[model samples]
Target chain A: MTHQQIRGVYSAATTPLNADNTPDLGLFTGHCQRLLKEGCHGVALLGTTGEANSFSSAERRQILEAALKSGLSGDQLMPGTGVAAIPETIELTRHALSVGVSRVVMLPPFYYKGVSDDGLFAAYAQIIETIADDRLRVVLYHIPQVSGVPLTLPLIGRLIKAFPHTVVGIKDSAGDFANMQALVTAFPGFSVLAGADPLLLPLIKAGGAGCITATSNLVADSLRIVYDHANDQARAADVEAAQVRINAYRSLSNSYVQIPTIKAMVGLKTGIASWARPRPPLMALSAAEHADLATKFAQLP
Target chain B: MTHQQIRGVYSAATTPLNADNTPDLGLFTGHCQRLLKEGCHGVALLGTTGEANSFSSAERRQILEAALKSGLSGDQLMPGTGVAAIPETIELTRHALSVGVSRVVMLPPFYYKGVSDDGLFAAYAQIIETIADDRLRVVLYHIPQVSGVPLTLPLIGRLIKAFPHTVVGIKDSAGDFANMQALVTAFPGFSVLAGADPLLLPLIKAGGAGCITATSNLVADSLRIVYDHANDQARAADVEAAQVRINAYRSLSNSYVQIPTIKAMVGLKTGIASWARPRPPLMALSAAEHADLATKFAQLP
Candidate 1:
């Protein structure tokens, strides 16, 4: 755990939007607080589930600012600052630091596919160097399914070697445990956070750090229970039960288009209908789907 | 031809960078002027070939503004305004409109993959409605290889039908002639511009509206000749010869990583080595690759 710079069940919090589709800042910050109250270590705001890419840079800055202004300490937040372009990624990361948030989850410059490792390394190096700050802690984001950019082992190693203190962790959302295991094996002390909910227990047991996941948006308490006592022999039954609950929430969330469904589930969890509204390119679930989900959601552990 | 809204051999011009990697505004503008003088209908600056996605929004605006300031008319500069973020795309497009430029090659919001046609439709529809500029003409960019988001035919049809005047054309860079043919067959009046160089002749003959291609950066005259005389029975040999010349340049460029090699070849063509510098996430050719390419480039038509 010496290299466990970021260790906990951090919620990849889904953003709550108003009827006009703008981010409902008040609702979003309240949800962040609830995740914390329920045992989330930190709030990974502005992630895939949060629909960060759909919003403008100004909105992204405002969302992070709003979360901070809501009284969440900087260390309790890890915002995704990576984007298709390098300058904006740098700007977003700097913006996070300017507001006292030091840790950031960054995706690679994802516009070009099949880019050489040299090219990717150069992009990251240039960005990190340009935003030269000793306090910066970057958790590389590897979600090839969504971003079309996979942060490879060699690239991660290069980043770690170049900026050992700055580049601390990774959010392995590729949903591959083998990859996470390999990352743990390769880089000791470098945090390996699970991007999926179900893997958090196994990953933590396997010398991995923790998780920054979507299901945590709904079942943070269960995840926190699992994380707190996964290794406790006397609490083995509790761990198993919490895991089942987390899986139930994850399964229901994945039953529809994942992000929108998670937002809807959040609405059902909090009894707030506006929580169901996702921005464009991610539609709100239809009435029939919502009813079906509500039935299944009620039956969860 | 009758339904052609955007018809011409528009060079997807390669942007040259200075030593510090800033857009060499002077060289870029000169390249645009040269592209026009060499028979290109317009300079499609800040495109895939131009490495538009690599630059920040501010940089993209500056490059486009530099072209317009260098005496290129608004009609002769089709900058790529679309990005993964819709608001920035809207802002960039609006900026273009404000400067008297109407047409922009817009890529779909590309961060999320396997998104539904409905979601994508909503994204573009919302952006267009938000812009709400009558002078705005968007040429939908469809390069699935580079931009993971594909502008499917159904989606394109919906866009054209929804905003008949604003949604004017498509840059079909999937390198699939069959898809281009289907688009031409399905949407008669919508501009179906070839993304590849060799397809220009066949696409034009098959009733497509010219091209917006990378090779046009190197061999604009040949592409211009092919477009101007594809239907002229007397100029059949000229078109064939021009197409052959165009293919030669394309093949050499493709021999290496396409964009950087094209930038390097542009350096060779203009005898300014500075043209070889590409922004990060896109590397310059090694000295050896450049030397080999230079030798072969000298032998090209």
Candidate 2:
């Protein structure tokens, strides 16, 4: 109850793309607004699920701005600003701050894996010091399976110790509940957000703040219910039902490559064909795959 | 050999840094010139050894331009321009072509691991097609251990078939000689460069085009000797002796973390401390480590 900075369910929102493979800003903005309307605490845009790393620096900046300019408040938006290059990370973070957004989810300088904790610390310290923005809040990203750069407990402790105010939370996406539980036990008053949908109820019960998950893009209502009532004895049944619905969505999404499938599901849920199109290096679902998914998706709770 | 396209010893040049960790453009250009003078065929700046991903897009462009401005010809420079983001990769590559540097080492879009071959193929095809420059000649980068994205043989075949002229060669930095040999066997007229120092002689013997190696940063003279005389029976002894020297340098570089140690050894070789200052996310060798390396470095053949 005491250890939460970023609370409740945030949608690890998927960005829609036009035929030309550029971010469909209007569609993207609408999705962000819908996530908020659907009970997401915030739109955590440009995360891994959002394919932030797949987009160029310019495109990332544009996507963030589109979200804010389309009437989402700075407080309701938490865009991912990290990239392989520290300078660009700085540039992106500064752009967010310049546009009145303060919170960002940042992956480490991920291109160089097997890097020493000293180097990783230096990278983050330099970024925070260089930015020198007191309003900034960074949720340290721990998606080692994807980024290939793990934020170990010691590293997270050091980052928290050094930049206590700025480094407020983390999104653990490794899908290991034991590891997530360990993170919660290790850090006090720091948010530990589940990066997976299935863990939302259990994590919230384990004193985690909430989640920023791809399933929230589809089942934000259920995720919100789970987050809000995880500790309530009377509401346990409702929360369980919500959790089941989320698991159903997550299961179907994982049937294909998670991110593209999630996007395809979002398109199905919204009836927006553009939602199905992903940028290169993350192929959009093939026609038959999408049709198959659509049929299965129709039977989801 | 008839299969070779880009044939020679190319140094995966270690970029020198200022005290602030910015690319010391003058020193970097100087190192490029010195690498060429030391008998390297060309300076392959901004590969992994160059910490290219650690640098911003603007910084990457500057590093490439600095080499050209300092009198290196287009044919004498092959910069690595691929990055996690497809558009940035395109931007960097297009910048290289715009500046008359046609040959560039390109890594596949690497953020999404376990990606489908179709997605990977679409990724490369999009970049190549979007660039659409006839002058462009891509040396596919296959460093799975580092980049987390391997340019598989099948993927390489697909790319080469699609853009036979543009996708001309590959730098197989996976350090897997079997993979390198397989690439050479499967693709005729495709240059297969060894990513490690020790493999140069054997790869050349097995029909690899040449090498783009970190050890070449310190032992370019030896690598060039091996590349030139690997197959000549009359020079076998000389090549063996040179490779032995290259191995000695590489061993000491690996005595600590390879990249920082290579930079430190480059400093030791050139009597320039600036070479030791890597950007954040790559720590410089400690003074004690440098002193120890210097002691052993002086004894190398």
TM-score of chain B taken alone, candidate 2: 0.98
Which ranges in model 2 have alpha carbons more than 4 Å from their true place?
A: A1-3, B1-3
For residues A75-95, write the lDDT of model 1, one tens digit per residue: 999999998888899999999
Model 1 interface root-mean-square deviation:
0.9
What digit string (tens of lDDT, one per residue) describes model 2 on residues A1-301?
5657788889999988888889899988888888888899999999999999999889999999888889999999899999999999999999999999999999999888899999999999999999999999999999999999998999999999999999999999999999889988989889999999999888988889889999999999999889888899999899889989999999999998889899999989989878888887888888999999999999998
What fraction of the true Cα-Cα contacts (under 8 Å, chains A to B) does candidate 1 also have? 0.91
Query: What interface RMSD does every candidate have?
Result: 0.9, 0.8
Per-residue alpha-carbon lDDT of candidate 1 for residues B60-149, written as tens digits (9 for 90 to 100): 989988888889999998999999888889999999999989999999888888888999999899899999888899999999998888
How much is A242 displaced in model 1, in angstroms? 0.7
Kindly report which residue pairs in candidate 1 clash with one another. Answer: A3-A189
